[model samples]
Target chain A: MFVSGLGYIIGETFKGLYRNRWMCITSTGVVVVTLLMLGLFMLVNLNIDHITETVKEQVEIVVYIEDQAAQEAVNDLYKQLSEHRQVEEVTYVSSEEHMRRLQMQLGGMLEGYDSALDNPLLASYEIKTVVPESVVELAEEFETYPAVSTVFYGQGYVENLFAVTGVLQYVGMALMLGLAVTAIFLISHTIKLTVMMRRKEIVIMKYVGASNWFIRWPFLMEGLLMGLVGAVVPLVILYYLYQYSIEWVAGNNLYFLSLLPAEPVIRELAKYLIPLGTGLGIIGSTFSIGRFLRV
Target chain B: MVEADNVSMKYNRCKQYALEDVSFSISRGEFVFIVGSSGAGKSTLLKLIIREIKPTAGLMKVFGKDISRLPRRRLPSLRRSIGMVFQDFRLIDDRTVSENVAFALMVTGASRRDIRKKVPHVLGLVGLQEKAKERVCDLSGGEQQRVGLARALVNRPSIIMADEPTGNLDPGTALDIMNLLRSINLSGTTVLVATHNREIVDRFKKRVIYLDQGKLIGDEQKGIYTHVR
Candidate 1:
């Protein structure tokens, strides 16, 4: 009985779709536009997150050791840096290696120090941090350690990068929210037109003793279908567009403007688009039903 | 069964009461008539009994429940037990006779087997069994009214209210419709006909409630219409 009831309601919903052909199409079209914009912004937002992560990876800290530091101090400093949770990677530069690099940088100008018994240059440890912001505290803490001469981690650049990325994430979220809300109202208004056209049928249903839910099911189903269809179309469009754009960028060899892998991004977006579209559509129809379906 | 006690109503448009101090009770298995000229509060009184509109003063009851104060959600249950027929028939033009009859049962949550079983039985009672698949729009007025009757009778309701059921039919078709109502009444379901048809009222010789200027002027058994203008 329940099965038949659902079948009947579904059948009725389709009948209504056919009966109000233009209105259903118009509402579905509105959903398509809304979900498409949502997809576009979501893609942009994800890529921004990816690019910021890449930038964070490039940030590093350099700690110069004093020339008078003993070998035990150098070994101890290497162990301390490795044990810290935020230190992702560390490379040591001996005084001898520093002198060689200096020689390579300035041809034969550094050849005067080639046979010197005591080296004038300092040894250093290059530190890559897991979190970009940790470099500030790491630099301060390193300055307090004995045998550490100086620490420079480009503090100003790291802070500015983080701040800009934080704002972009927030702005992206706000834009998506605004568009979803606008789509809900637009879907609802169009469904309202559909409801108005069916007012007589609703009145007849009331007179014939139809339960409120029984009467409401068909409209709800219609709204759900509209939302699902609307969401799916944009995903298909976005899939092709995203694939083409990703390939276009790869073909141009523009590695600096790193785009996140397209497949996972599309898969991730599908999860949200379907539900978001349907939820908005249902909300719209519910309001329309409330406004027009007066008993 | 239905009862009214000092029921009065005045619509928003006028200070004059549509029905004033009207009191009556309709017993089970009785065929009753509410006779009045146009604007004599016939429709208003019917609307009050159906609880379609509330009476401004006093109480009304149907099936032993205080219907004037019945909550909106409970109204459908009340309405389900009573079948209503309008002068214009009110059948969906696009539906076939079987679909129209089934529509009533479908809304009440009847299974397809039950609807299929009951629709034909009710249509058979109205003598429209052969016209089950025919579209109501394609039928004659008499046939269309029969479809309306079949829709009303599908639920086998305890009471049937026809507000001028014959108002749109020719004399021959009107008489046929009256005969159907009479047969339905004979089967022990209460019937209430609101009409100014003096001929059928006299012929049926049933209990009659007469209204004039929003007041009950007479309640008689086996009575005919007698008020002039």
Candidate 2:
């Protein structure tokens, strides 16, 4: 009984979809456009969150040592910084390693400086704080050390990045939520119109002793189909577009910024967007058919 | 098979009553006609029996159970036991005759094998076996009503209530439909028809329940369209 009934319901759902093909297409289009906007915002927000976290993790105070500082003073300073409660780690970069890094970055500049005597770079202690926000106080303390020649931690830029990313997250979420609500409303109205055209059939079904569930199953399934199509279309389009974006960023060598990887981001987006779209479709049809069920 | 005791129904927010102090009992296998002019409550009484509307006052029972007190969940079971035909021959016009008939069985969770078997048999009973594949919209008014009858009978309900089933057909066609109903009744399925067609009502000479101004004016066994008292 259950198998036959399920077959009947599925058959009816397909029949209804064909009967109102234009309406289904229109509703599916609405779902696609809405989810696209929401998905784009979600991707952008995720990437933004990734970029900010990367920058925050790189936040550290670099204290350059004086050229004449005693070896004991430098060792004492490194041990003290590592023991500090606010510091997570302290790595000492010798002047020779510093000149080698400059050679790698600048490439060909000071190429003849093969000996330590020609290396003008000072040895430094890099301090990683437990909290990125505590870098200001830690940098000030490091600058007061007698062996320290200079202290730097990208103070203004780091603060501004954190503040900007926080606001962007909230704004993106609000916009996505608004788009979702609008999509549900528009899709429901479209399904409502389709159901209204079939009101007589529903009444006839009721008169023939069909339970409410028997009549409702078809419409619900149709809604789910429309939603699934809507969701998958945008996901496919976004997947390719996101992959291209990551490649474009890499190809252009925009080294100051990095995007979240395409595969994982798109996969996570699909996980949420598909269910949301299908759930919206069901809700739309359920509410649309509610008024006609009175018969 | 059916009973109504002092039933009264008034539409919501309306002062006029649709059915007032109407009482009648239809036994199993009985062929009964409810004859009355428009707004005389013939259709309203049929609607009441089908449990479409609860009476504003008094008790109504079908198969010895008070339908007025039946829970909403059980209404479908009550409706399935009684088949109903409409004046408009209400059917899905785009579908074939067989599909329309099969729909009645499908709703009650009948198996596909059962539908495949019963649909052909019911179509044969209505003499539409050859036209089973034809769409309902393409059939004549008489043929459409036959399709309606086929749909109503496929469920094998104990009672059949038809509301002006032949209102759209000519006199000759109406008489043919009436004869079909009579034969169905003779086969031991209780039939209740609501019609104002005096010719068909008189020719049957079966039980007639007369109504006037929402009241039961007369009920006579072996009666005609017009009752002399």
Candidate 3:
């Protein structure tokens, strides 16, 4: 009996779809457009996240030591900088070594200006901090050190990147949510119109004493079928587009965008698209039938 | 058996009454006719028996259960014991005659084996066994009415309520259907038919309840259409 009921429901759904071919096609088309737009937004958002992470990894703070410090004192300052928790790496550049490297790069251009330097440049240790935010605190801490002259890093660029990425993530999430709600409402209303057209059949079923579930199951199944079809076209189109775009990026060596790896992104999209399609279908069918099912 | 005590039904905030202070009882194994012209509350009374509509005031009992207070969820099980036929011959257009007959049993979760055995038997009883494979839309009006009757009788309910079962049929086909209903009643199922066919009333000579303007004006045993011309 259960098997027969299931068969009957499946048969009925197909019969309904065949009878209203144009409406079914139109609803599916709407679903495809909605899902495609959503997929595109998600892809762009994922790439933005990857790019921000890459930028964060490369940002570092540079610390400088005092000019008059002795060689022993400079070595001591280097050890102190290395021992700091926020410091990634530390190196000491002597005044004489720095001058020699500059002269090799600009030998004849700087020959007349050698006597102008009454004082030698400071022999400094270059310290790289692990985190961009820790630069200010490190600079303040280093200022208290007797062998430290000054500390500086790109504070403005770091703050601006964080703010911009934060706003982008918020806007992306809001847009996706709005699109989902609109899709659900549109699909549900379309299915509701279909139910309204066949209300005479529903009334007869009710009079014949069909259970509410029995009356509703076929329509719900129809909605599920609609959702499945709607998701399929967009999913296929988006999947190929993602693959092609990733291949293009890889081929042209556009590494600065730092896009998400293709495999993981595709897997995540599959997880989202299937359920989203099913939910839209089920919700639409339910709303349409619920109006007439009320005894 | 069916009984109604002081039943009254008002609609749209008591501005109009469909059935007013009506009371009657039908015995087991008896064939009863409810006769009246249009707007006489015949359908409203039938709807009350099937629990399709509740009375605004009064008590109705069918098969010893107080149906006036029955929950909506329990109405289906209650209705399974009572068969109803509509004037329009409300057969599912997409279904075959046999499938339509089997639908009543299907809703009650009857086994396919039982449906296979019983559907043919009921179709034969209704004299539509040959046309069982045909779609209802393909059948003539009389044939469609027979299909409706076959569907109504498939479960072997204790009582059958038909509202103008022959309203759309020709005189010859209507008489044939009346004969079929008589045979069904002879098989020990109580029948309540609501119609305004004076010829059928005179021919059947059954107990009749006559109503006018939502009021039961007369009741007679072995009665014909006795209201004034």
| Clash pairs (backbone) in predicted model 2 | none
Model 1 Cα lDDT, one tens digit per residue, B1-229: 8999999999898989999999999999999999988888888887887777898998898998889778878877877888888788888887799998898898887887899899989999999999999888999988998988888888889999998999989988999999999999999989999998888888888899999889899989887786434
lDDT tens readout by residue for model 3, B135-211: 99999999999988888898888988899998999999999888888999999999999999999998999999998
Per-residue accuracy of model 3 over A42-98 as CA lDDT, tens digit each: 788778777876776666655556776787877777788899888888777766766
For residue A11, what is the lDDT in candidate 1? 86
Mark the 10 consecutive residues where model 1 chain B has the least summed lDDT.
B220-229
Top of the candidates by DockQ? 2
Q: After superposition, how far is residue B150 of candidate 1 from its true place, in Å?
A: 2.8
Give the better candidate number (2 or 3) by lDDT. 2
Best by lDDT: 2
Q: Write the per-residue lDDT of candidate 2 for residues A108-181, one digit (tens) a residue.
A: 87678674767788999888899887888889988998788999898799778768867877787787788767
Displacement of the residue B19 alpha carbon in candidate 3, Å = 1.9
Evaluation by TM-score, superior candidate among 2 and 3: 2
* Local error of candidate 2 at residue B76 (angstroms): 2.9
Per-residue CA lDDT of model 2 for B108-155, tens digit only, reads: 888878999999999998889999999999999999999999999999
Q: What is the C-alpha lDDT of each candidate?
A: 0.85, 0.87, 0.81
